[model samples]
Target: MLDLTAPSFMRAPHEQLVRALDRSCFAETRIILFGKVKLVLGHPEIQDMLKDGGRFAVDARNAGHASPFGMKFLPASLRVLSDNLLALDDPRHRELRHMVDGPFRRIQIEQLAPSIRETADQLVDDMIRDGENDIVAGLCRELPLQVIFDLLGFSDETRGKLHDVMKGVAGGGSAFDVVRAIFRLKPAQAALRREFENVRSHPRPGLVSELANAGGDGGQMSDDELLAMVFVLFVAGHETTSHLLSTATYTLLMQPGAAYQFRRLGREARLVAIDELLRYCSPVQMTKPRHARRDMEFHGQSLKEGERVMGLLAAGNLDSRVFRNPTQLDLARRPNRHLGWGGGPHMCLGLHLARTEVLEALSVLFDRFQELALDTAPDNLRWTKRTGLRGLKALPLRLQ
Candidate 1:
């Protein structure tokens, strides 16, 4: 078993992990036991496995250990929250997926595109006025959190509370950070629960309200389910995008020529560049793990039942065979199919929101801040130690 506690992957550029996976692939390796659990990194084998969900299950309980969030706090509807789409297998998965996927329908998210762009623009204007700033704190973090709060119909006061909760939860320190963050969220969770109770009488026109009131033949969302969804959206929506924006900013600053090209090429060009950035940074390095139900062969290796599979999305994004010169950041590359937001039925539900946010933020940053430069060496910036997250702790910048 690889000692994950050794901090082997920590501090190293994400490339090191990709290289490790690549080597393992050529060696026809399997079962990389990191801290007792084996992580399957080979893409071709993983893709084939994920494709056949019948044999290779994605169900939560059957999949693996309890969710990190669940480990922190048990909600009223623990079963529903745990067994929701992401935690279910096959036919059962399809049922819950239909409900959650309803709101994220392309048409629904597309309608919200204008709102997303406006939010990005407004935040950028503030950044430009501030002169020098930490884009992560200033623009990247605020924009997505605000958008998700708005979608949940959270009042500004409640939104402020949520921000504090997220900061305390995601910021620094040891396991105590989780305790602190959870304490901060308690009040907000109570407020949200109250709102959920009153939701039927006075439904609001946001995603949370929609899920709260989803009924009849189609909707499977329970009150507890709605609360869990809100918490997930509030956290993941902003955190992942924050890293994306920060990393993309760092990438562009490093490659001025590419940044200039992205700005000059217009909307379509900017979109293409954003796609590449998503692939390159792949903000969420690891995903919630999936467990194997029965003994199976993966990449010519036999695996026994009761084992887990953690998808290394970063590894897939940097696969040398799939992406030419995968290490280099190429904004102009076409046919980019990065697994940044993920794939299959459990792909990121807020992908449209995320894509729109990245596009607008990049456009505004490059267009307005022509003199943007890194205030510190990118190498000097420390990456967050969290295994599943890839982002800088501090991104100091000078905007003249």
Candidate 2:
């Protein structure tokens, strides 16, 4: 069994794990580390499982039956955090998703391009002034956090507080750390509840206002649900994209001539390059555990009711049958159907915004800095000590 929480796996994950899993005789194997999670590695099998909503559910709270870590003992605050759209099933998911779907659509997100470009340009300017700094800290971290703060209409004070709160939440890997984060998150949640109510009373031009006004068959979400939704958006919206920017940039820099090739690409081509980067990086390494709705046969393996299954998205992205030369980074790779953003009804809600941030941030960085290189040795660079999410601890670089 692979201990994904170990420091070694956190550093370099995708290659060896995928290789071993792909070569394994079973399509799915039990990993004792993440509560004995039944890891689904094969591309086709993962796709089928993601699409089969009738047989598989995404409620993490209800996944206690499959969790070896004893999630039933988790605090109510922690349990409420799992009540967002990512954990919802069917009608409720569809309802809440429908309410907020229009705002995050491709066309809607494209409207924010000007502001995003401006923010990216400003971040590059700051980096240029510093001459030498960690890209992860200076650019990668700030860009997404700033964008989301602007989008949500959060005040500067609130933004700083929220950043600290999220850092506490993301920094933890163990059960004890999670409990600590939950305790620290109480004030943050209360603040968000206040913001939601404020937005409800006085409409503003932001996602919070949109969500505050959202209504459907299920009626308005409770204060707890709203708080959970905001928490998800804040965490998922920034954390994954920030890591994507850092790792994608690192990957391109590491590959000889890859950065130049990416720079030379046209607008549409650059967009394609972003897609390829997403495929290659597979930043969010795995999906949240999905519970089987009933006893079922999947890929010749029998799964009991409520058994947990996690789609190894990074593995599927590197599957040889689907992507040729799976180990190589092809900037112009076409017909790329990588499950980087997951699939089915539970796909990432902020994908358009994320793509926009990556494209603009990378473009600005390479364009502004003439000769950019790593300040530290590649081996010295560290990965965050967190499971499910893969990202750099710091990306120190010199821009001349």
Candidate 3:
């Protein structure tokens, strides 16, 4: 069994697992679940797995068994957060996606760009005034949290309340991890349930009203589904992006030439540079477990029906077959249609907004402090020890 908690593994699983990846396109990993499941490591193979919704299922019901995302350990009371898009397929997935995805479309999020930049600037200003060096708390966490809360029309008090709970979220999907997350979420779920009702009675700005009034779009999403959507939106909205912003900053600072190169780019070019960083750092290390729809031969491996498979997004990002010098950080690399943000039908729902926030956050940080540098030694920095995610615990910086 792979010891997920092993210090060496937690510190750098990719490096340790690289051999398995190099040896074969498909391997077995018990790190994520109780039973060993297929781990897709190659770039092309992972892409095929993610895109072939017919062959692979995010909702395990479509396969054969019922492996809902933590459904067994997940409490009924908290079904509100677990029964949403991540656990659905086909018409239902598309329907639920269409319901709330309106506000997140690039054109729509573009309208929020000005506000996003303002929030990024305000966060930077606050950090400077407080003489803060940790960019993770100063900006990475706050930028996305503020943006998502703003979209949800949440009050400052509510934002503060949920922020505390979300910040402490434990990542592995073990039974223990699931049980622990449930208790922490109950309070926040109740609070969100209230907000959903509030929006229904009185219209408000942002997605809260948009979703609370989703019935206007000729569909009725149940309360549990709605709650899951809202909560997932809130959590997913910030978590990965927070990591992306922090890790991107750390990567750039460590590579001064890359930092200098990024700074020279205009808005358009900076967006391109963001993709390269996304490819290099790969904030999301793995994807939700994908179940095989039926017994099939893939990349020479015989997969049984209902067998769980995981896409190693981080590993695929390092595939030499696709990316030249895959291990090296190249901020200017183009033709970079990497799985950093994900691919296919189930790609990140907030990709547009996330890209915009990370881009603006990076731009503001670099522009404000032309002499920015790491305040601490690289080895001393902390990283979040979570399965399927990559991020910094804190990114201390020096602004001169």
Candidate 4:
């Protein structure tokens, strides 16, 4: 019944700009159209709609857009991955949050500081050793995946399957892609399931093992649960970070003075630059479509129950009211309230970890790679087809 011949949902630069302009206007328009989906863009009244949980919900089920594989697979696969925290609301979200929050503490991540830097250094070294290459494949993609793999205690033996699963989940939006994604994940899941079962009886010192053996009120995750969380974390966590790093690096490479300014600032200052890049790139340009659970008043419009809303995170970050000269990319934008990570209870659980990864990775690049430049013409670059995640698929570069 689905039209396979229909062109996949791809947004052109102009279309992206148009949607952006609509949001920048700062008017409360409930039914602004976006390709096929109607969105609620830039409603100040929605401020309460976001923080007030009981009214607006993150249920993507009714939104019915076919892009997010996680939303569609919620009944099957994502329920497990989301088990630890992201899926729950209210007391449950708080209860589960308290237990796992300890592991992601600044001190705990700080302890992994050496490991994080080592991963970035090794990846950069490898890239330098191998002259011209797709930076995404050689550099951007490997860093976070390695950190997460090491953290989860997955073996080098399973790296192939791990990569395959990530690819499948990330591109599992269209009908053509869905079949391929499902095929890709089936074998990967079987392998992970076997490993998880093996580890349950004999625990290891990794995050997966900890989750498997964890007890107390937080409730230990089931095998499916473990695999799903690991799956999402490995894919979503690294993929977005990869985008931020690649796009930020590319932006600086394109702009002469920006990279120089960024480098001179040192680690703490570069972190601020990275934060601006996150807002500027808005890699996860859009978030899950939120639907109203009840009649909600937002930015002057009255929305009846069941109306769908897509929060334009990039637009929200660029609103002139919140950010001065909203279009300009000033790395030192103080009090930057960008929602690079979404807000509310369902805010990205791995945000701190992600911040650490991006900051560390960018720090290394600025330090090691001098006179970094693109190997090809700007027109040759190809943007990825993901509606939610904005990034370059391949970045051919030369390091001096």
lDDT by residue (tens digit), candidate 2, 1-400: 6565566766666677666666752344434344567777777888888888888888743443633222556566677676678878778788877777776789988999889999988887787787748888778878888888888787565676788887666542444565577778777777787787787889888877777787777687777777777788877877778889988889888999998898788878988988888888878878877888778898888888877788878778888888898878899999999888889989999999999999888888777765878888988987875667778878988776
lDDT of 1 by residue, 1-400 (tens): 3322224454444567566765675222122222344555555655555666655566534544455222434544343345444555666556655666665666776777788878877876687687747777777777878777777786566667667777765552234455556655657667777777766678877766777777745465666566666666666666678888888888877765876777687776777888898887777776566666678887766667655566677777777767788878888887787878777766777787787778777777778778878888665776665556777667888766
- Candidate 4 local lDDT, 205-273, one digit each (tens): 887777777877858766765665666677667867888877887888776588888888866777778
Worst 10 residues of 2 by lDDT: 61-70
Q: Write the candidate numbers in order of decreasing lDDT.
A: 3, 2, 1, 4
lDDT per residue (tens digit) for residues 1-400 in model 3: 3344454654455565567667887766565344676678888999999889989988877888754752345456565565677778777888888887788899999899999999999988888899897889888888887888888788566677688776656332334554576678777777777777787899778777777776754387776787778667766767779888988898888775878888898988898888888887778877788888899998899989888888888888888889888777777788896898777777889999999999999988888789889999988877775656677878889876
- The model with the greater lDDT, 3 or 4, is 3
User: Model 4, stretches more than 4 Å misplaced?
Assistant: 1-35, 43-47, 60-87, 171-179
Question: What's model 3's overall lDDT?
Answer: 0.78
Kindly report which residue pairs in candidate 4 clash with one another: 81-228, 81-229
Clash totals in order? 2, 0, 0, 2
Candidate 2 lands at a TM-score of 0.92
lDDT of each: 0.67, 0.78, 0.78, 0.65
Clash number for candidate 2: 0
Model 2: lDDT equals 0.78
Better by TM-score, candidate 4 or 3: 3
RMSD of each: 3.9, 2.7, 2.5, 5.0
